[model samples]
Target: MRPSSTGAPQRQGVGRRRSLGVWLRGGAPGVWLSGGAVAIAVLMTLGLIGILAVRGLAHFWPAEVVQARYTPPGLEARLVLGQVVEQETIPAERLRSAGIALPPDSGETLTRELFKLGNRDLYGSDFVWLVGDWLQDRQTPADALVLERREWGNFYGYALEVREEGRQVAKGAAAVPELQRRLLRTRDLSERLERLEKQDIGGVNHALERLRLEGRGLELDGRLDATAQADLAARRAELEARYGELEDQLASLRQERRRDSVVLRDVEGRTLELNLARIVRAYQPNAMGLGAKLGFYGSKLWEFLSADPREANTEGGVFPAIFGTVMMTLLMAVIVTPFGVIAAIYLREYARQGPLTRTIRIAVNNLAGVPAIVYGVFGLGFFVYVLGGSLDQLFFRASLPTPTFGTPGLLWASLTLAILAVPVVIVATEEGLARIPRSIREGSLALGATQAETLWKVVLPLASPALMTGLILAVARAAGEVAPLMLVGVVKLAPSLPLDGNYPYLHLDQKIMHLGFHIYDVGFQSPNVEAARPLVYATALLLVLVIAGLNLSAVFLRNRLREKYRLLEE
Candidate 1:
């Protein structure tokens, strides 16, 4: 030991050199950084999933439905623009936020609020007029105003067109920036129009009554006088001819107007639509029964899952979007699996590894990094326009402008997503194929089996486990993709399903709706964001479940195949 002191010094020098080299390579720092990054990513993913789960589970939380009336900011009167006066007003947002589920007299869904100053008595002393400020001093009376709490953009469909001098003129009503020269209240238009028609007819009757009682139309001995009779005949004949001519001119116009008319309200009989802002403003606590908690929860569940699309904001369920998502994903998986597996077989079994193979590998890797929205845009361009046009011409030339394959639909969306995910599948399957030993192929060939027989019976069976793993990965990736499908087929709302009883009912060219797009539509695209918050959470939860279920199915298949093929390698 005493003689080894010099040797120990040399060994220590070598150890010091190794330590210095390790530090220079930054191994510790790199590992720490990588681990930290992975930890952060994992935490974020888990946090999001946790939040969704908590919210979804809260679907069973104790919730009470309350109905209440909304009243706007209480302002007696102020200088709307400049001049100040005794003008009465309420806020519109308050009504939207505080909507109560109330049916109109005839069972119409109208977001209505009872107001004190809205007596509408021409001679009433308590009548209040809505006033707005003209900057500082001047004032203009608003035609109408309602207010409640709600996020912006929830209410967009309700539009009012006030005619002035034979043209639509903006009368002070609901104030949405884009709703110029129109009226917008989340109330049913057909009901409103009918009520207005009745009022106008009453006014005409009242004017006639006044003319008869207070003017020259008084009867003499219960019989009309000569001059009165003559005047009545003349007037009747003139009006009848004029009315006849006008009715003829308006026959076609009325039908067109109904078809293209802007939605006025979300009444029960109308289509399923909502203006969340308007709903929130109109919402009120205690609007629905709160005490029967069990019944209420049951109803809410039904509403959440099975309601149909409705107009005037009547309750329709989110079933359509759910169907679209499931159908599209299933179709995409089915379409992609065969094509991807076949491509992998050719690349691994037949094609020689060369520059072309290297180039393909590079392209596949690069494709995985491309932005999803770009895929959507490409799908819209290539599939919807170019390929769809060709399909239409070949299959349904009779339905030119009516659109068969000429519009974005579930089929186009599935195909686009399949194409987008093909590279993932190819990479995974090829890697799986690579794992099969050459000895297995040689053994199969030595036993009087042809190359095809060897590939089918020996090599393929051995590689099945890896091929399935690739499919699982591809499915997992495809299920979560939203951007591309949005451009290809998903819509905010669709009137009918992709499968309907039309000519060639399995029409793949109609624009169908999906849950992911619904989230985007309800959260950001809505006119009122606050009123739609709960709905947004619900939709998000559904989307996560859909994605998870798809991944789980792939996993189940992978596990089964792995177990089945475990003996081959051994």
Candidate 2:
């Protein structure tokens, strides 16, 4: 028999309600929310990275130089030439408040362009803001030059002539090639001079210092024999003779560097002489084709990676900071891994379950939440003062008052970060150890393997991936930590790298630059904010890349270990 229409409708409604109830009960809504949240987070991260890449990477591209005449209210019209760095629209009232008079017909909001007028020495500023309406006769001159310099920031002008020893060797159309050729020569001389000063002479100085320290140590030990003294004197004489030769070569290079100079005429028709040695690279940005610009960009990027800083660190590369960050993170990993794993093994396999053990685990967990700066203070007081001072008093007594080990340095920084990261390692390792089934341990014991042997051979091999996971996390945290390193060993600019060709190749007692601190210094502490802003973005991007690279390496190792030990786990 056919069902009634109302009854059939009621049955259909019942069926729909049942399906909805089942969907809710099955957790489909929660799953959707979780997936959506993860997607949003991934998108946000990608967006942030994209912004950094766009802003930072653009700084290396050569921008066309523009020449224009700007007429400010109540001021004489003047010629201006520079790269247009930025533009913004602001309330006209704000400009008027800052002494800029706007015309009656001007809108409530006005647009202004930030010109990177370089020529810091001539203009007393690297950048200036000019209202869009006031800028007239704008043109991109192909002959306009942008001179990257070692000091006084960038110089923007038109190349006039190349002078060698006060005589005009090349001028007009031929001047750019002559200047480029002379710059190449100066670059070679500069490299040679740097090698002589930093390596050859530096080695001699280091040896002389070692000799002095040895003699002092011998004197303290009551073993300063005449033969030892004679040996020390001969070594000192040889070092001093080598130093004298380096000095002579350095002086000759300096004289040769001063021989060739480039004469440039500013937009204001004023002539200026710049030594070829001072110029890093001179390029006509407006004249460059796409291929030339790309090549220049590559070179600029390479320079940012390899060159030493100049201009109060607002310019140049961050190689030292990069080295220090990686070295410290690696050292921290080395020191923390053994301690963390040992502690975890003892807690999980050896320690009796009791109130004391529980309390210790709680403390370790709490330590992971502590402020990083507190670790810095503790490290400064204990590692730098108490323990380091004692070491200096004992092993380095001859260097007393100088305090070789009793100082904030690479060792202290690494130790501080190790302590900061240990809690993470401990927790991860403990979790990994607890995950292994009891049958695995019991089988190993039944096979006549000792507990220690079981743990070392069977358990550890399976847990290697977890160990690497902890290490990856620790490295990520330590590499980007700036607060602790600021107090421990990080400096604004390190004159020398901690690792070099010198004896005791790894100088743990020396101060080092860190990329995290470099970003902070460049972003906040730089005198030229406008000039340094791009560098800050570039450096921040570099630091993120470095941390990502380190983590990827660890992740790769972890994956390899997991694959190798998959069968054992199964």
Candidate 3:
């Protein structure tokens, strides 16, 4: 070896080449490529979530209201009051082509500002675009108030005076405090009226409906005697009396609500008297300090989560949608788990394994690939029409024309998703069952246990983690599915939640709102695109958080089950 110096250099080069070839053969290059792909995917997901959070959360912050004197070409200068919501640059040539004049020294590009001019009642538009160069001496006024009204979008103006019963109660600085005080009183009155209308009066209405249905049912059964008719009449009379009392209270509240009003002067020197009862909340964004604005932001976020939808679901909170989504997902989980586990157990443990079993497994796998809408159609036909219609005829013949469970509703929706998700559970459970060591099952049977007992006590415990995995996957799927739900239950705005104080409080027969459907409705079906845009982002963000929370909980349960059964599996 010491005698061949020239060949030693060649051997060293050959050794480096061999090492490179071994690396490729060991699959290191493929592993590196796969890792790079996974990293890119993770980064994209994070970026999307970050964008959603920023856009959605910024909507709640109070923006400073500015007064701008804008002049258009060959037109008189006008005072504009609004919040600057967006800004962008455009080519001057594009503006010139659109018949918009540019200054002699204007650069190749021009800037434009989109102002949220939110007096929809007066202007018929909530937003306006102005050439930034034309806006002269923009000023933020301390007295500029933003009134979030219950109707006609938002109002931006200066507070002039507060009046009660056609008399001026306060003016200027004094008016704001008086206005806030009256607004609090009005809000309390509104909440009281809502409770009376939705809960007390609603309960009476429900009782009356049930009484009518009972009478009809008895009539259909040929069992409506004089005594039964008398009982129904008494119940109806009682409910009517309660309803009449609520009506009188509501009338009195309305009269009180009409007593207070506020005068607001726009930048154009026009005064409009707005009823204080119609305002949701009024705030002076330019006057607010950081602490006050933070509090306002928190309050707005809370209201968004807790309040009911208003303005055709473009405004107000989405509590009903959130409740419906969570309730439906949980119901689907409950319905699917047992049936899935039973089917998997039967197929794997009891059935003879052969070519027929192989064919059945292949069919089950194919079912997992079937379109979700197909499942929805099947659910509508089988669950809603066939089974529910039969039940209606047998037990609810009195409510003939008005179908209860026979129509699209929460129960049918849950069942549809359950069927769609069952294949995942069956496949996971079968894999888990197959993985258990044969020795363990034989040992349990040898220790004076029957085969069934051995399978239940020993085999299932070891397979619990896999079962949890399947359930978690099913939950993730069911929570986000929209198309199938559209056919079965989901609606845009459900005034009353399915789980109300009505009889059979878990009203599975009721149509329910869902977060997925809400996103669809707000994003595409909204009449006011600008007003609903930010809300769409906020709702979508909340939905992502909800899904993440559910998945995390399931993952935690799965980890716990794995830990508890680790030694048994070993």
Candidate 4:
């Protein structure tokens, strides 16, 4: 407790009263330490973010141009197109086909530009290295690095041009003995069970026949033996028990047979051994020729952001992922806004302050803290499997075998994101609602407005800016989230948008693409990952910018609305 200058208790701090000066002196050190730690953390975070931003932007800068003529060392062996032409008169196409692009063929033959975009693979395979002639200077680089196509190997692993079926056969050979033994064991067990089942039935039928024979003998005035009667009783009970056991064994055998008889496809050479040894031996030098040189800088940014999803690495862009991310975020905003607002309104205005509201408030806050991946599981179960499944049956029965709601797609992505965003929206809206003056509601009621009318006409209007502010926060959170989206819809690639020009154009079963996923796929998964590194940074920057842009727009909108409402206080 701190006493005021008037010698009255001005501040309460515990059970005892204390002078403000003494209290301040005692607590200042601890306050400063905690504050310094916070400040340091904030500064470190900003510094790291600044570095990433700068490095990423720098990657988009164009390299200094150099003109160089094709020349080899005095020993002289150069590989191009399929034929090694003389250093002089080597058609640009010959070099271009091997992954080098010839200068603009504004009037050159079609053969020269044939490999530009449509045939990128032609160059990627042969032209693994580049050398600059440095045309401005008389000397070509003393050395040019190159890949020996005849002996091509790289860090990504060696591509052995072998039949996949041959590989599958080789792998299958390794497992043949074990597989054969299991198959034989299963077949023998099935036969044994079937034989025993037949025997059990026969024994039961024979027992009944013996009982009839004994009954006929008794009816014919013949005395039945006591042993026979005893035997019959024991035999009947034993047979009945055996019958039950046999039935169970037969059922078990049937299930085992079904499970064991899965026909695995024979190896047709459709698999490749991932060669790690050759990969370790691949040359990794940082050198570039004219065509490869062009891939960096602003052109790298443009290609990465604008490319379509391709089969391997030779072709494609990230357009689908960018489209999906933006579309799903917008959809989530549309969905979460209304439900969150309504929930906030009920909780803040209509509900009485009691244990239930307190409990609910605690639960909502806890939900917000749950790890996002857990939300992905929940969405997969509830939204995709439960709700989307039902929708597929009702509206997409004709497309069975192929899933509609059953597969990951855009609608499911939107719904999953909306669920994840709800807590954020609810918390934000509640805070906004809390900040409104109670007198505003009272004034509206005083003017003869119904509770709902007053809420809609006065309270919400005054709180509009805050509501928008809350929604902005919700959208920002939902847009950047990747884990939940991964489980719901994001794939490495997609052929078409969820919505298109065809009849009932929205196809939600198709796994959609997304930018966050693209960065992951290219950086870690690409065979040409060494080259894709710069592209990865370029894509990451785009994603950050997109989310930033969204946040900025919402901030601007909130400010405008806040300004408009503030004037009324005058």
Candidate 5:
């Protein structure tokens, strides 16, 4: 009886082991592991994007300005006016170690608030931390004014009076409306000033520079005849006359802009006279209703998207960076697609299946894994120094010492990114070509088409989807590349876009701003850490969106091509 019972238990254990082995062999565990990994990766990505969005998008929202009397231990009570930017709890002991006093009744931890005291010219800092407990008589005054400035960061105070040419135009309750009305005038004048400076004067300067270069070219070519010299002088005189006229217009516009000023009294009761031209926008946040705040937010957001960056790139828009990134990526796609497709076609269709071909294929695959900085170095050496120098010597000799194409610029940046992205394209294209059935080629040949005809009309059309797929991959990789662009062409601030109203408008030999590099510059290299922090987040989010937008465009084209060729594949 005992032996039979032991045998039954042993049999049950054997049955359990068999079931476990079967489950393992079915691959359920591997499937679950892969799914879990993918889920974790997706969750992490979403969390990061959420953080970026929250931190970035909130910067444009106008928060009510707080007025309070703060009394710190051993310090006199003073009025503080600014926005409460952040709040945190710190240990009481830590505060004491930092030479801050806490009351004896204070518990283990004490809360503090960070204020954006934006009268930087007065306080010498944009931010200050004060103990929440020490703040008394906190209020959001409806008359508190926040001035968004082009320089010296932001100014927070109350409106005192509006002035025109040192005369008080309006005061007391009437000043705000008068200031707003005059601000409109200043904006119009400022726009005119900018147009005269950048367009009229800039065009004259461009023409003058071209004339100078032309004369240099004529001299270099030994063609500086009396007629040519006289013609050049006449054109120069004409451009100078135009420039003088534009400068007069610019001076008049500036005088009009500087005509109006506003008197603002800060919390310290000291008054400041700010020119209307310096203030980009002004509003009392506490006085703004929800609808007005929303409208203001939308305008600020639009400005961030379309305006040029100001205040060391901690304020204003990233339009130049956006334009440059898209331009370079498109140029890279245009340059890389044909080269990658041709190489792929050769490797798959023309090359003999030998050891040399295999070795070349292996090398091409390995190039994709190479560090991007290595490509930058190679581009700087070969593309910029070698090829570009040759081009400059041959064609742009008049701009020799200045080095037009010989310098790091947009062309080299695009070319470098193309080289960096080509390997992926080649591999993707090769895979695509390999997938085409051999019978399709043979069938085309049987119908009297030549090899080239069959390849171009029959095979290549079928492979268009593959070409787009490769382009999508290339753009996805290249658009976010910063290290290579930094060495090739990207700059912290590009004064003008690569594309402008000038003849031969697309200036490939000009430096350009990139979204990736802007994020890097604003986040790491900026001197105002607190002010730049929000901009860093905003710019990072923008870059991601830009890359995603570019990828989606390529993806859409790829899908369309795939749909067009779906029947052929079947």
Candidate 6:
């Protein structure tokens, strides 16, 4: 009886084993593992973006200014003031091991606070670490002001007096309001001065240089004559007159900029005079409401996006970097798109499917795997040293000593990135071309359409989305590439933008700033590490957004092309 019943249990066990084997054979384990890997990857990406967003966006928000009375072991008790940027708790034993004497009543863990003690000129350091036990009477004063200046980092103090031309316009807390009004006026004057110096006067200087070079060229060609000399002299006279006028205006602006000064007293009661013109902005963070803080955040974000950088690019705006990145990427897209599409078309449609063609395709694919820095080296050698030098010799002989085109600049940067991105485009476009139904081409040919005509009108339109797909990939890679750009044209700081109000607005020969390089500079090469920390995150987040924006635009165009041609395919 048991043997007959056991046959059923044996059969059941065998069935269960069979089911397990089926599950394993179906690749369920591998599927689960792959799914886990993808989920982890997605989480990691989101985490990175979320971290960047929080750290970057928070930098713009107005933090409450704290005034704490701190006393070291042997030092006199005095008011220590700043924005408390970070706080960490550590084991008391670890603090003691580090030679920091803990208070007798301290717990097992000791807290250390990082204060952004700005006012670099006065304090010699922008940050300080204080033991929590040493900090007493910590308070956020409503009148504690923060002055974001064009130089010397920042000032945290109480506004004591406002003076205009040695006369006291206001005194005590009342002076803070007057200081604000004067600061606005000074900022306007400074902006005007900047425009006059960078644009109006800078243009004149450029013209003069060009004129001198043209004269040299004339002399080299034996074309210089009394009439030419007279014309040159007259033009020089006109430029000189303009320069003098600008100089007078600049002097007046400078005088205005210096007419007002602010007297501020720090937490230690030390008084210092700051010129109103130097202050980019001022706010009482502790006094600010939610709306005021939000408005301040908006203004700061805008400044980061729109303003020219100052303080070794640790402060102010990254407009030049943003502009350069977009311009270079657009130029790269303009260049690589047609070349890549053409090459892909030739390989897929025109060229014979032979060993040579296969070899070329293999080489193109291998190019995508090449180290980016190798491309930088090639660009520096071939594009800059050789190609640019030749161009300079041929067309810019008049500006030989300066070597206008024979330098690392915007054109070479675009070209280098275009070269870097072409392989990606070629592969994408080739795949796209391969996906197109052969009957579409054959139908066009049967309808009396030439191969060229079919490609241009029908095949190409169908593949336009893929063309854009390739472009999207190209732009995403090109915009964030710092290595090739550093060798080609990128700089830490560029005084003038490549595109400006000058004739021949797009200056391909000009060295430009890039957001990727800017992030590198701010994050790694900054003089004030603590102060520059937030800027690094802000710039990085902005760069990510910019790349995303460009890619999205291309994606949008691709989707539109797909929609527009979907009916054609059907």
C-alpha local distance difference test of each model? 0.59, 0.92, 0.90, 0.59, 0.92, 0.91
Q: Give the per-residue lDDT of model 3 (tens digit) for 34-152.
A: 99999999999899889888888899999999998999777899999999988999999998999877778889988899999988888989898898988998999999999998888
Better of 5 and 6 by lDDT: 5
Model 1 lowest lDDT segment of ten: 78-87
Task: Judge candidate 5 at residue 448 and give its lDDT.
Answer: 99
Q: Check candidate 6 and list the clashing pairs.
A: none
Candidate 4 residues 1-570, lDDT tens each? 775575444334432545656767799878989999999999996776676677565544432211223343333433222111112324446565777544563233322111001112223442223333311132212111112111232112112232222233222333333333444555476557646654565556556655665554554455557876677778678777877887787787766654421112201212233222111111111334555555544454565567554434323357777888888888888888899899999999999989999999999889878888888888889888888888867765554555668877788888888877788778887887888887777887988999999888777766777778778877777887878888988887674676754334655566787777777878888775544665576567778778878888888988887888786533
- Candidate 5 contains a number of clashing pairs equal to 0
| Top TM-score model | 2
Candidate 6 whole-model C-alpha lDDT, 0 to 1:
0.91
For candidate 4, the lDDT comes to: 0.59
Let me know the TM-score candidate 1 reaches against the reference structure.
0.57
CA shift at 6, candidate 2, in angstroms? Answer: 2.8
Q: What is the C-alpha RMSD of each candidate to the true structure, in Å?
A: 20.2, 1.2, 1.6, 23.1, 2.2, 2.0
Instruction: Score residue 486 of candidate 3 by CA lDDT.
Output: 90
Model 4, C-alpha of 138: deviation from truth (Å): 11
Q: Which stretches of candidate 3 lie over 4 Å from their true place?
A: 1-6
Query: What would the TM-score be for candidate 5 when compared with the true structure?
Result: 0.96
Looking at model 6, residue 314 earns an lDDT score of 86
308: Cα error in model 1, Å: 2.9
Task: After superposing candidate 5 on the true structure, give the runs of residues whose Cα lies further than 4 Å from its correct spot.
Answer: 1-23
RMSD of 1: 20.2
Candidate 1 stretches with Cα past 4 Å from truth are: 1-43, 53-291, 309-315, 500-505
> How many clashing residue pairs, candidate 4?
17
